[model samples]
Each structure stands twice: as structure tokens, then as C-alpha cells.
Target: MATIKITTESVAALTKSAVPNKTTFYFDNELAGFGLYRTTTGTGTYFAEFRPVAGGSKKRLKLGRVGTLKANEAREAARRAIANAALGKDLAQNRSDERASLTVEELVSKYIEEYVAEHKKASTAGLYRMLLKKHVKPRLGSIKATSLTRVDVQRAHALMTREARVSANRAIKLLSAAYGWGSRHGHVQEGMNPASGIKLNEEEGRERFLTTAEMLAIGNAMIEAETIGLPVDAGTTKHAPKGQLVVMSPYATAAIRLLMLTGARLREILNLRWSEVDLERGVLRLPDSKTGKKTVFLPTAAVDIIKGLTKLGSYMIAGESAGTKHEKPRSDLKRPWAAICKRAGVNGVRIHDLRHTFASTGVGDQMGLPVIGTLLGHADPSTTQRYAHLADEAARRAVEAIGGKIAAAMNGGK
Candidate 1:
């Protein structure tokens, strides 16, 4: 090692020279222990040599590559390393410890494999995986799990809210759950959930209930889609295949009917197996649902719809390849639903609103809230209370009926 003034020009001149088969070290004459090493291949690296403890062994810390870092920039880093080393701090070991720490990405993988996949429902597990992939992992994956702060979570939540508020809320909750699970299982430090207590974006409740007239229109549209095929949208058919029409599959049509009549969730109907459906007993025994092992009682109309559908392998709502070696449940009824809604002239109503419609219809017919709650498979009675206004309307009708009967009897006696 030779003591020389380390500058950009000096390092450049050394790197440009083709010094073969020998590595040379040049220490800064002005700053002790701060230097650069030029290899036999003409590449250079900046390093700082210091005694980690007073009068103890010397340790070397690599600052950066020659061209990637300026001489002044590297000197400043070396100054900090040397200053920390004088105070008995091992900067090199600190960097190595940071590199070896568990990151948020690894924690998510561990949580998914150990807890989510094992304990959560398949549908829930799938949703959690999607949210983590699309939102959580991309934003915070590289962050060290132990050092994650609530501010970091707040910033991510704020950014995610711009695209999807509901999904943002759910994603944060999922992340919080992962952290809690990690803490319990020793993967994370206790009480260190950065995602906890975030002020989530306000999401409006979607409580659309179809009127009786709308239900009749939808029923008519279903009939047309099943048989003659509903009219295609002229706007969508600009590059049409001659005289193409939108005809829903029989299985899809039945799925919609089941959704309308039984108030079952979309997945519950789509994944319904023949073994779970007992038409004779008028119930669908779902082995696993969002609520776990639920039984949906089918009314006469719902039972008739299921009875009419052909049993294609296991699933009642079969895909096109049902009964084949590649048989599986239909993924979704998005196209069929769009056609039906378009023909019915329904606007801004989701498939989930069909469930609201079923509950509203029951409430309108004077079925008590408890009865409606049981039919909808609501674990909490409060979940069924959204239709309390409709129940109030039913009560008003019953009171009017009693009053009219008493008045009529009194007049006849007169």
C-alpha cells in the first residue's frame, strides 16, 4: 500500500493503466485508513480500514465501486464508518445483520403457508393471496419486518385507496392479520403490527333491493336468454360475427335463478355439488362456505329450478367441459349476468344485490327478521338488520289488515 492523495483524476489515471497480474492499494495521504484498491483487471473499489475496538484488531468495510461512487462521496461514507468504528461500533457487522434480517415478503410467504392456507377457507385464502400479490407485496415487501412502522402502513394505505377503497381496507386488514400471526408464531417481534389502527377509507354500503316489477323483468329476460337468446348490444357488436346473439347456457340461467330464489352467495351456488344438494329434502348442505358448513333451505321455486338442471358430474353449475376428464365448476357467470341485466333494463345492480332482493321480498311478505336471517345464513342477527325498514313496512300492513277486519265486523253488526 502506498500513501497518495485520493482524487477522481488520480483514481481514473490508475484505472486506465493496464497493470497486469498485481493488485495495488492507494491510501489517502490526507485521511488515514481511507483508500481505493485497483485490481489486476483495472477495476477499483473504495474501502475504509479501522479498529472496531480501541487498540484491537483492524476491520475493513467496503464503501462502493470506483466509477459508481465519486471520490468525495466515498470519502464521506468512509469518514462516517471510521467515526463509528472509533466508538466501538462495527459498521460492517451491522450491514451484514441488516442483510440477514427477515423481510415483509418472506413473512407473508410464511404466514400464507403456515396459517392462511391451513386455517382459512379456500375462497378466503385465494382472496388474501390476490390482495397480497397485487397490493401488499409490491409496496412493502422489501421492508424489514421488525423495523416496519405505522407511518409506512399509513402511506401504503393512502396510495392504495386512490385505486380501490374497499380493496385497500381489506388489504390492510390482511397485512395486519399477517403481522399478528407472525408475532404469535415468533416470526415477528411482539406488538409490532405496522398495519394496525389505520384510518381506512370510507366505503358506502351497497344495499340495492330489486322491486317486484324488476324481479318480473329479470325473470322474463332469463326466459328469453335461455331459449331464443337475448338481443346483443349494437354498440358491442360493431365487429360482429354476422347475426350473433347472446344466449346464456342452461346451467348459467339456473344459477341465476337459484341466486334469485334461494338467496345463496355466488360461490355457494357455483360450487354446489350433487352430493350436497338433496332435492327431496329441499336443502343444500354446503360442506364449506364463507361461514363454514352451511345449509341453504331451498323453497319450492328454487327446488324446481335445481330439479330441472341436468346433473353434470359433481357441480350443479357446470362449466362447458363438465362430465369430461377436465370437468370443473364454472368460474363465473359475468357474461350471462351482463346479458340478463341488459335485457332486464336493470342498472347499477350487482349480483350480490340479488341476495338483498330475496331478503327484501321475504320481509315484504311478513316473514319475521329472524326467519329471514336464518334463510340468508347470517351468523350475526345484526347482518340481517339492513332490511329493518322493509320489516317495518310489513308490520304496517298487518296492523292495517286487523283494523279493516274489526271495522267490517262492527258495520255488519250495525
Candidate 2:
């Protein structure tokens, strides 16, 4: 029988000379469940040996090795096990139960119903649902939430990144949040969030802005497409094939121009109705937006586009007037926008990028971010901080001017 002192000093001082054979156990004096177990092969490890407070067979679990764990570290691990045993908790069994029941789809559904629907904004909840349905559900939804690993999260992100990088990150973000939600609600064991430490795909923030030349080209393309019609492709000019011919309605052209002039999102402009346009106030008072009730300060250029629309029905861009097919306002300008992009040689550009260009133009003109944020109707100043790059140039210009003045003053009229 091995003597049982089990202190750092005592365990370190124990000699191999007293070894009998087989294995030996040395229980701790201060910490009840902590002990040292060694085999005849000279292998030794720290362990926690305890019977349940609910009355069952005692279980022994290895904590760590003597040399690698240090006596203090091993004791701390043993203390945690002893604490769990006293509480009648079996960590291993709980993990098994979680693995059997908790799945990615189940956890996401629970998160949306219990947390998102009640707490998050309606628009946010909708976006989360869409992201899960399109990106997450089809990929990792069937996997056990507890069995989820960092590799699995990374793989799912990789699959979507080839199509759209931002979309991939959003899906990853939702999964991460859902896992945390699961942990809090006891749907899964705590600290079992695989999405927590997973490496998300590196997303290059798209800051594409139309140059003056490019803008001129787009302007000419819009005119040609609306009036004379243009080829759907680059090389197919005057003698284009039958399917290669495309044209943008004057109304659709105006909508695309408004996107370039105002920093409002796609839905904000597409779903815009005649009632929302306040020609007298010169502001588009959107009753609801992603950021809640917001107002977009329409520049003269944007105002011209809205005023030019015929107001065929309830919408500014309504086609077919009072027809039932076009009653709910123009839902999309996808085809027109694509034709415009192709004609202008601005291929690979998304309609959303036009919003970025709007902000970029404001920044280049030496506008403050707060003022731009107000123009964009950002609810938070920090939300407008992404445009801080434009502010940096203005700051540099101001500093240079001030430094020049100070140098001239200090030169003593030299």
C-alpha cells in the first residue's frame, strides 16, 4: 500500500525504492477526491476518485500526469471533478445526452423561436431565418450540435464563399450565435460551441466606387439602352444576335440612378411607393427600414428621378399602371440593372455597390461622417464609422494647411 500525503512536496519527495510491483494509489489529505496512481511500468498520473452523492459506484478519472500537469494543476482539475460528483452531475453522461438530441437545425429553430422572434427586431429575425434556410440548413443542419467541430463550421463557410463572401460570413455568424444560445438554454452542454473558435472566411470589404470616366460611360449606356437599345454583351454591338438584344425601361433606368445618388439599400428603393415621396419636404420619409423608421435626404439628382416617375399606381416605378400584376410596387430591378451593368462594362458589380459609391462620393467632397451618417439615416454613429477612411483624407488636408500656416508664422518673415 502506498502512503497517502498527496502534496506537491510530498509527492515529489516519494522515492522509487519503496515500489513493490503492479500499481499503487496515494490519496490526497486536504482534497478528498484527489489522488496519485502509478503502475509497475513507472507510469504515474493524477486522478479524482469519488462516489456519487446520489449513491452509486465510485468512478476514477485520470486528471493529468505527474511531470506534465504539476501537482497544483492536477489538484485543481481533481477539485472540479469532486465538486461535480457532490452535485450529482456526470459530465460524460450529460455530453452523451446532448449529442443524442441537440442538432444544428433543432438548435437554430429553438434560437429563432425562443430568442430571436421575441427579442430581435423583425427585420433582423427575417434575415437570420433567410440566412439559415439558404446557407446553413442545407449544409450542417443535420449534424449533432454537440458533435459540431471547428472544421465543420469552416467547411460550411467555404462552400458558400465561392458564391458570395459576405453571405458566407453571415451564415457562420448565425451558427455561432445559435450555438451560444443553445448553451445558455441547456439545449447543449456549456463550452461545447464549435462555432466559437472556428475561423471564418476572410471577407474583403467591397468598397468599389465608380470613377468619373466610368460614371460617364454608365450615363451614356443608360441613355442608349433606354432610347435606342443596346447589346446584352460586350462585343455584340449593332448586328447583335436575337437573344443578345436588351433594353432598360426609362423607369428602371431612373431607379438605378437614384441608387447611385442615395445611399439607401436595395429594398428601400425598390419597394418605394408614391406616398413615401415628399416633394415639398425634399426627403424620402421611409415609414420602416432595416434600422426602423428612417429618412433619406434626397439630393437634387435623386429628387429629379422620383419626380420624373409617372406614378402609374401606388409605386413610383410601377409598370402597367393599375394592373393587378403590378399592384404591390416594383419588387425588383434585377434584369434592368444587369443589362445596365453589362452595357457599361461594369461587370461583376452588384447593385448594392452603387450605395457604397454614393457614400464614397460624399466622402471625397470633404463631408463629415456624422453628416453622411445623417444623410444615410444610420441609427448609430458607430454604424457610420465604416466611412471613416474618407474622413482620414479630409483630416490630412486640414492638418497640412494648419502646419503650413504655423510654419510661415514662425519663420519671422523670411
Candidate 3:
């Protein structure tokens, strides 16, 4: 075992290395006796090791697994264990008591309060809560945390899969996380995550992308929507006078343009603030993205789009009627996007498809996958590897072009 300052980045970096033949251990520098052991397969389990008495052998208390509990959370667990040990408390009996009569529902509540609320983003926490309440609680909530078998988990997953295949997978993921947290924190026995090693539902990738012609149509439609406006739906116009048209906000049009120009996620562009935009540096410095802090380099076209847009309040994409005392960013561009797509004669294309269109355009142009990945702010290279086939297609086209020239020369320039 090696002693070092443990951090989230350092622990994550371990996954990049080759797996060991046996379990390896690393301890925290700040908190001695608090460490994590990595199995031969690369999974790590946090633990607190200390002598139960002054002259007695040291005992190791398992805290939680890596990926489920962050390094800080593990450290906190180690601290609590040390404090309890100092008070002459029996750690083993306390752990047994903690696990006694604990149900899946109770574990879910504890996980949300102690772990999810403190560690997860608000959006992610809300999604977790929804998954637990709607799917997991309905099926497996009554089961004892220690007694939840893999078969029970499978049954719940199957039931949810019959209704929403994707959500079923996500709910199982959350349940697994809760069980893992429970085990680590002594609410359940170690290695009792029933949701583990289960196969998730096969989900088809939604990778819709626009062609050049389709992109042109969208651009023209944006212009039209901003100018003449699209016709209001009969259902919506029922509450209004006749002949009222729905005009797309300039901010909405600009937001769409940015989405196409920059291969950013919808929320990244929608929730962007003025302070985050560094026009001189040509980058958007996001403090907190889905993958933590990220800097999005702006291309010339994207920069031009931003330059042309007038800042309405603090946010680049202002909500309805800016300049109010209580201003907020636009929640979504659903209506504007739908209206523009309808006018463009494009059907079944989501706003997110614009991001795909941007990425595909780059891939089609033979930009290197690493370069494209960097522009898209993909932390993992494997994520960029999704476009590997697209890169092969580009290579095939290049070879064909070269062959065509040779054929033309062979045929006397025919």
C-alpha cells in the first residue's frame, strides 16, 4: 500500500491504467489509516484501518466503493469511524445495528439525504429522486436492504422495462448506487448490491444529423420565423383573437445558430451567461458543465454570431421580456425550434440534432477525431471514438477520389 494525497482526479486516473494481478492499496496523506484498495479488476473499495486497542491488531472497516462514493465522502466516513472508536464504541456491533431491519425505501431516503443532496447536481438529484419514487420504490421498496436479491432487482427492472425501457435502465442504475452507498455506510452488508452485474436494456442511439441542404433549410426557416412569424396552432389560438402569429424571438434564433455553429449541449448554450463569454479570447469558460469546468473554443462563425447578438440582461439567451427586475435565462427553446423546423419542412428532428449536425459536419470534413473531440469538450477519448466509423468513411472517400483521377488518366482523360 502507498500513502498519498487522494483526490477525485487521482482516483479517476487509476481507471486509465492496466489492471493489476492482485489487489493494491493506497492511503490518504491527510487522513492516515483511511485508504482505498483496488482489486485486480480495477474496482476500488474505501476502508478505514486502525488498531481497535493500543496493543491489539488493526481492524479494517470497509466504507464504500469508488465511483459510488467520492474520495471526500470516504474520508468523512473514515473520520466518523475514528471518532466512534475513540469513544470506546464497538464498530462491528454498530455496523450490525445499522444494517438491522433497514428496508430499500429507507436506504433510498438515506442515500438521497446524505449522499445525493450533498454530492450530485440539482438536476441529477431530481432525476434520481424521480427514478427512485416512480420505479424502484413501486417494486422493491419493501424489501430489506440486506435481503434484496439479484432476482428481485431483475423483476423490478423487467416490470419497468415493459413500460419505459430507457428509464428502467436508469432506475436500476440509481438503485445500484443506493445499495452501494448503503453497504459502504453500514446501512447494508458489504457486496450486497443486487442491481450489480445485471444487463441493461438495449437502447438505440439517436444520432440524427442534418445534411447541407437540411441545414440551409433550417437557416432560411429561422429568418422567416423571426420576420413574418409562423401561424399559431388552432388549440393555442382558441384563447386569443384571430390572425395572431407567433414570432420567434431574436434571442431564440441566435440560440439555435449557436447550437449549430458550436457543438454544445442545449443547456450549455441556453444557460450561458454574459460573464462566461470571453469574446477577446474566443471561448466560453463554463465553470460548471455536466463534466465539470470546461472551456469551449469559439470558431470564427460562432464568434460572429455572438458578436451580432445584443446582450439582453445578464444571460446571452434572455427569457421572455428582458430588462425586468427579476430576470432569468430562457428555460428552453422548444416552441421556437418546433416552429422553425415546421417551416423548414423538417420533421422528427430534435433541437439536440443540431449538435449532432455540427459534429457530423466536422467528421465529414475529415477533421481528426481528437481535434473534434477537443472542440466538443469530450473528456474521454472513447466518446470521440464513436466517430471512428465516420473517419473511416472519410478515408474511403479520399481513396476513391485518388482512384478516380488515376482511372481518368488511364482512359485518356475521359
Candidate 4:
């Protein structure tokens, strides 16, 4: 029995002792209808247990620890536990019951396991995991599901936007979906999605396209640099002879030329497989495209590039290997694209813009909107209508050609 006076000094002195195992501190007084006991069970594990002296039967009430819970703090807790015990209430059991209710972190885990994996695609599941781990979990993981507010969600979204606008919008959408899932199931109360009214800022339209002169300049630069060779890692012994080195696969040069001739999307051309192309039939079959499924008929210039690519390897575009199952058919084009643009003296012309240039050029050459739409694989006609102004300019050229034909006919009759 370790006897300690009911004073604040004695409580502090008793807790600082080097007792390795369980030790109980006993108070001298009856404590005025309150009984406080400090129980130390090994290092760092300390708790204050309280029992009533004046009221009913003995009921143990745990009040935190020794280091965290001070002598004054333990006395305050003992007083409350005495009052609650006198009223026949169990304070410790009530706290345990309250904690048994679901928290936001627990609900998020459940949502991912039950909802996200089953319904959404693999990429979507990956996105949800990233948003929750990076944005939502850190700020609101400990909050109770029923207690979350709209302001909490607003702050989370705002924090994400500080880094990136697109990421912020994606986080807001994921949060909305999670809360909606919580509401549908009984984890959260009805009509209580915190992210319900949040809206993302409008995104700016893509307006970057290269001119024919700019395209020609880029091709000329690639011809001058002639740096096409396997790039060895720095400090390695695999250095190539000076002036003999050339950038890997002139595919950007080939891809740009093909896009200008066929007006196909950059991805469609970059991801093209040898199995998908029919050089004999003069058509290229694109199995997976933005418009679902489509094919492009190659012109003489585009066909010549395809024939030239077959001499390189299995892939039509002999660029960087994407580490896919088939070594030949790659999923992406590497830095040769940027190197080509650097040589061309063109600023900010992305690979995708080559496709835009192709469309604009087709509309400039008197091609019909319907004809250009088919060539571009536009899922909706409205998508192709953005290039209608260019189509109208081409129509004027066609009208002039017809006018010249009519004049020639009249002159021949005279």
C-alpha cells in the first residue's frame, strides 16, 4: 500500500517514482464523498480511477493518465465523476458508447471497400485513393461523420486549389461522392453532404495551334541537329562520337507530317500498331479512340511515311518504348518531340496542337465540315462545328472555282 496524502504535492511525487509494474496510490482522507486512485501499469500507462464514497455501490471511472492528467486535473475529474455517480450515472460507460459511433476516417475506409472498388473504373479508384489520402484524410479524418459541416469541406477544397485548380475540382467531386455514399447508407444523417453546393471554376479553352511555316521550321531544325541516337545516362561510359549523335526517332517530324496529311489525332498516330494498319488497303484502323471506334484513309504522303516506318520495326512510330507487353508498340512519345520543337524555334506548341493544325488546314483547303469531322473522328457534329468558320472560308474557294468554270463554259459557247 503506497500511502499518499490527498494534497497536490503528494500526487505529483507519487507519479514520478520509478515503479516498473502496477502500483496504486491510496489517499488518507475519505475525500468528501469522492475516492481517487492513480494506477500506474508499466511505463507511460497511467490512469486515474474514481469511486463514490457517500452514494451507491463502487463504480470505477477512468480519467485519462498521470503525465497528461495533472493533480489539479485529476481532482476536477474526480469531482465530476462523484456528482454523476451520485445521480446513478456511469460516466466511463457513456464515453465508451459515444466513441463506438462511426467517425469520418472509418466511413471513408468503408466507402472505398464497399462502393468505389465495385462500381468505378481502376483509374477512378486510384484517383479517389489519391484525393482522400492527400486532401480529405489529413484535415477531417478524426471528425465524426454526422458532425461534418459545409465549411470544413469548403476549407479542404480551398487548400487543394492553392496547389492546383484541376486537383481542387477533382477533390471536391470525390468528397461529394463519398458524403453521398455515407448519406445513402446510415453512416451520415439524411441531406447532410458537406460538399453539395461546391462548384469548380470554369476552365479556359485550348487555343494553341502551330502554323505550317512553324511546322516546316521545326522539321528543318531536326534535320540540322541530327541528334538521333540512344541517350545514355549521365556519367556512364556510353558516350557517342560528336556530330554523329542524333535524337531518337524522328517520329515527331513523322507524326507532324502524318497529322498534316491525314488530319488524325496525335494519340491515334502515336499509339498506332503495325497490326492495325493496312498499307495495301490505304486505311488505318483505330480500335480505341476518343470517339469510341473509327478509321482513317491515308493519303499518298501519309502512306509513304507508313511505308518508311515499317522498315524501322513492328511499330509504325519507332519512338520511346513504353515498357508495355509488346516491345514494339509503345504508349507514349518521349523528349524527341520537345527537341524537335526546340530546333524549330516554335514556342509552346504541344503534340496535340498538331492535330488542331491538321483540322484548321483541312478547313482551309475547301474540305466540307462533314468530311473533316469524319477525318477527325468527332463523336458529335457540334464538336466539329467549332471549325465551321474555317470550313466557310474553304467553301468560298470552292464557289470561286465553280464561278471560273461557268465563265469558261459561256466563253466556249460564244
Clashing pairs in 4: 218-344, 226-246, 227-246, 227-247, 228-246, 228-247, 229-246
Which is the better candidate, 1 or 4, if ranked by TM-score? 1
| Residue lDDT tens for model 4, 144-248 | 877788888788777878887887787778777777777544456534688789867567767566786897896676565445442232111134554444554
Q: How many backbone clashes does candidate 4 have?
A: 7
Q: Residue 404 in candidate 1 has what lDDT?
A: 87
**Clash pairs for candidate 1:** none
Q: Which stretches of candidate 1 lie over 4 Å from their true place?
A: 1-100, 231-243
Sorted on lDDT, best first, the list reads: 1, 3, 2, 4
Query: Following a full C-alpha superposition, what root-mean-square deviation does model 1 have from the true structure?
Result: 17.6
CA RMSD (A), model 3: 7.1
- The positional error of residue 104 in candidate 2, measured at the CA in angstroms, is 1.8
Kindly report which residue pairs in candidate 3 clash with one another.
63-184
Q: Clashing residue pairs, candidate 2? A: none
Off by over 4 Å in 2: 1-102, 232-244, 319-331, 392-414
Please report how far candidate 2 places residue 359 from its true position, in Å: 2.3
Where model 4 places Cα greater than 4 Å from the true spot, the runs are: 1-149, 177-192, 225-246, 251-253, 310-315, 318-331, 396-414
Which 10 consecutive positions of candidate 4 have the poorest summed lDDT?
A: 229-238
Error of 2 at 260 (Å): 1.5
Q: Where is model 1 poorest over a 10-residue stretch in terms of lDDT? A: 234-243
Task: Give lDDT per model, in order.
Answer: 0.84, 0.78, 0.84, 0.67
